[model samples]
Target: MKKMIAVMSGLAMIMTVSSTVYADFGFATEPDEVAAVVQAYIDEKLPGKAVIEISEAGEVIVKINKTSFLNPNQQVNILTENLRSYLLSNDADYSIVRVVYDEEATQPAEPTGPEEPAEPEEPAEPEEPAEPEEPTEPEKPAELVDPEKPEEPEKPTESTEPVEPENPAEPAKTIKPGDLDSSGTIDVTDLTEVSLALLGDRNLTDDQLKAADVDGDGTLSLADLAKLRQYLSKKIDSLD
Candidate 1:
């Protein structure tokens, strides 16, 4: 009676441990879910003759049969690549242990002997030649030189006067810095134009752009706007 109670307790303990493991690893509630997935993967790769066995203890075994054979270590390489990738990516815990291969599962079928080479055929007899015809004369070579020579080109006359270089384009007019509206003075309108340019709605011309570069940094950024505002408020004498 005591032994019977102990055995029942042991069974209950086993069930509790199994449930704990499944909960921790996110194992499927259905007993066949993982096994079915593994079976399908093996079926797709090895077709009808390969079997996959997944144990409740998280062990995996691959069995290759005689009816289907892989091409020399192809089974090992394919399984290692496919299973490791699937587990690492899809398995909740990214863990797989005790993967075993059944090497002596079944004997591979013997290959048929190589085919014999076909016998060579004899050469056919040559036909009789026709009577020799009279030898024909060779054609004359083409003429090497033309009868007339080309006329010589006339030389251009040299100019006695010296040539003058073209005048360069006038440089852009330099304006006082912060003169955004080209009013020749820093005013509220110039500050408003600079603000609009900074907002990106309005564009400034080359001279205006240079003028608005109050910090002389060669760029018309927000710092230029701040400088212009400070200048308008009499915070500074000139941006130069």
Candidate 2:
């Protein structure tokens, strides 16, 4: 009788612990339709022990019971990245997401094993070649060039007053085809120069960088970089 009472007490405690730990979710999807997709994704990206519980949350299907088939002793950053990629690829519309992790009850779940770099996602079969983007129609810069190219200055004209070199007839806007950085125009020869300058393989004059940054977010992140290359490519091809 005493043993039975002890077992019942333990089961009651377990139920209370589970109820306190389980979190609610707001995401939605047809559970049966995407269950396989979600399961497959979990199996591949997470090789070790991790928990993935998929079920209906009220009207929506979800994996509210976040656990691991792999040991939960994994790097949080790596786990976050894997989760972000999974969410972004399959369901971009559902950006409003909440990831509730149990701090007290959770383990430092990191993959103890060596990690393989994620494989590149296969590109969707091209229905047609991608449409070419429109050119970057940038306004002409202010005239800073002199009318004529002066002979090289032999020495400083004045101790305090610096000599102003004569500018060419006009500022050259014609960029050669291989001028990737688009600073007044450097070519493959400028690759090293650029790399040395700001860690880019090609140098970018202030003007070129401004033109490349369409959103003006003051960042050369992947999106801005892609736009910059696209603009230069369009202009170069047009010249041909």
Candidate 3:
């Protein structure tokens, strides 16, 4: 009867410890009510060996503190599948339920030494500007002349004796009766001149008019032109 009492007492203690472990895990409750259901599921699979935490984005993180379960990786996968099925069955909004070992979660990052200081960069040299060219001086202006003191005029030389004026040219004398142009010949030119005079298209000189009056009436007319044409054609021997 004592053995039976101790066995029952021991079972009660195990139940109390399991309840304490589940309570100590403190599953997420404020941000998501579904977190309690997921925590309870993880507690049933891992018992007191796993902790449940919910991220701000409502992802379920199951950290296994003990690896005493056979095929821990397979167990994590099975637990993940079961939790995913439960969330799906309940139509919960949780998207991810990750299961990892405690060391993987709390492992310290490798220490990184300080980075070597970077070499100081040399400053670039400034370029010197080209020198400005000197300005050229302007040429001086010409001297101004005085208006009051004018220059003297040139002196005139002594005058010589007055020179005599040249005699006027002599008038041409009539060489012949038919030589009207004073060219020493009577030809078509004289005929043309006489014809132009008779037509009033030309003004003949005194010698030419005297010579052109072949009939000697002292006045030129068409009769003189006819007589002159007759003389030149040899029909009349004498122009007189």
Top lDDT prediction, candidate number: 3
lDDT of 2 at 144: 83
- TM-scores of all candidate predictions against the true structure: 0.30, 0.20, 0.29
> Could you give the C-alpha RMSD of every candidate to the true structure, in order shown?
20.2, 40.3, 29.9
Q: What C-alpha lDDT, on a 0 to 100 scale, does residue 208 get in candidate 1? A: 82
lDDT of candidate 2 over 1-240, digit per residue (tens): 999999999999986665455322323234442444444555675433334434345221222223544433444444555655775576421223223344333223656888889999998886987889999989999978685978676985657667788786886565443244556553433333333434555666765555444445765445544443444556434212
Query: What tens digits encode model 1's per-residue C-alpha lDDT throughout 178-225?
Result: 877777678999888888888898878888888888899998898998
Candidate 2 displacement at residue 141 in angstroms: 99
Reference-based lDDT, each prediction = 0.70, 0.48, 0.74
Error of 1 at 217 (Å): 2.6
The most accurate candidate by TM-score is: 1
Cα lDDT for residue 34, candidate 1: 53
| Model 2 Cα shift for residue 188 (angstroms) | 99
Model 1 pairs whose backbones collide: none
Local accuracy of candidate 3 as per-residue lDDT tens digits, 98-153: 77667443323459999999999999899899899899899899888888988899
Each model's backbone clash number: 0, 17, 0
Following a full C-alpha superposition, what root-mean-square deviation does model 3 have from the true structure?
Answer: 29.9
